[model samples]
Target: MTKKRNMWNILLASPFILAVLTCFIVNFALDRQFSWSLLTAASCLYAYLMLYTLIFGGKHRILFTYLVLAILLIPFLYIIEYTANLYLPQPIYWTTRLGIPVSLAWLAALAVTALLKTLTHANGFLTTGYFILAFYAAERCTNNRIDAFIGPNDSWSLSDHYPILYFSAAALFLLLGLITTAVKRSRSRA
Candidate 1:
């Protein structure tokens, strides 16, 4: 893609970028917090941008900038969880308690992105859903269920064999990506 096109993509995705950053500033500004849906959507956009940059950016400054900013976002998340009196989901909250850096979380996210490879060529919906669900499953398997930002209320413990949930979601993602690729190829052939 041309520089202009890349710029346009980043510009268009700026809302999501802002939303992700808001996790840092939100405590000072708003009484209410962002919903899980909103956070998940922002995360998906961030993941999408990162996936694009990592896979197809190729010396493009614009895409590289996006990727760098996304990496830098880890610090902002850290600041929010550490400095700000904000609520974090149980899975993430445990990380804070365990002193696991957000950079590691980001690295885990990168590994997920790279492993799936669906984010590179799939439609936005497919990619976004995959990213969201994959992370959600990770969160689930870490403790067994998704929880609110404050903490988990359910009995989702750390000892449960929730690996099935995580792996099943991953397999579903691969299946969807394969189906999409097959359809696109068939369309072009026709």
Candidate 2:
């Protein structure tokens, strides 16, 4: 059975490997170098790993998937930055400064989602609400970091109006989650 499963895994992985190889061959043929193809290979590898984890990760599939994502994300971004630097004419070296922080922000969102799931032990609605809120925070962090990277705009006011919209959406979702949880609890009691 294990042999069969391993064979199936190899069969599934074949397409991904083929695609990456094809990308590399075509890229090298066209450009006489392997710049963007490296990114393609890295992305394909990450996708395959995620798919494999979700399909065969056992009981803690989601948590394991998150772990896989966290471990691979840095290397993936490095590939992206390297590809971008090589492909672009200008020497754009923002992997350490911009990419890492943005990735960290997203990772923080994932951590919040995992924490909420473990702590609440309630329906998905509350967890989703928390996830959405965490996403908003992550986006906000990304925006701030980008602004700083792109040179602070002294002309424009620091107070951006976008946060209000995100905050309102988060608030609505939290309210809905609270109502749903309350109704579910009451129903269970009755």
Candidate 3:
């Protein structure tokens, strides 16, 4: 059983690592100024993971659901980024762009949900709370460095988007958790 679980973990993590490598390769090869490669790689990774989860049946259904939710959320985040670019007085830095609020939120959410799923095997509000706390800590630690590189206005304003994104991601994961639990309960009765 332990070996089986380890194999599952490797299977689940493989696509993510591949996606990261894809981004690196694209970044190095294209030498593009924009970081679109990362986004593209992430999209591809999410899609691959979803397919893998749906076909193989694993503990990653919740994570896959969050990935799907994050993909759905990209448009909304792009809207915000576009709108903010238009309304804000200064030119928006690409790095600090507020385009995908939910995507960022989803990252925080996913991290929290993964942590909870690992530690307690529970998917409750506490998971969300941990996500929020972790996000806050991360924001605090990174804010200064980000501001220094992106400019103070860009750093301060865009930073707020992270927590929101994290929460949105967490919500998706939580929803998936609930659904998975329901399915398991039903199957057990049968």
* Model 1 alpha-carbon drift over 4 Å, by segment: 1-103, 110-120, 124-159
Taken over the whole model, the C-alpha lDDT of each candidate is 0.56, 0.84, 0.61
lDDT of 1 by residue, 68-160 (tens): 665656644554444333443442343343324434544466557545554476664456546666575455444422343336665645325
Q: What TM-score against the true fold does each predicted structure earn?
A: 0.37, 0.87, 0.32
Report model 1's TM-score to 2 decimal places: 0.37
TM match of model 3 to true structure: 0.32
Ranking by lDDT: 2, 3, 1
Which residue runs does candidate 3 get wrong by more than 4 Å? 1-46, 54-57, 60-109, 121-123, 153-190
Give the Å error, residue 133, model 2: 2.0
Query: What is the descending TM-score order?
Result: 2, 1, 3
Best by lDDT: 2
Which of 2 and 3 is the better model by TM-score?
2
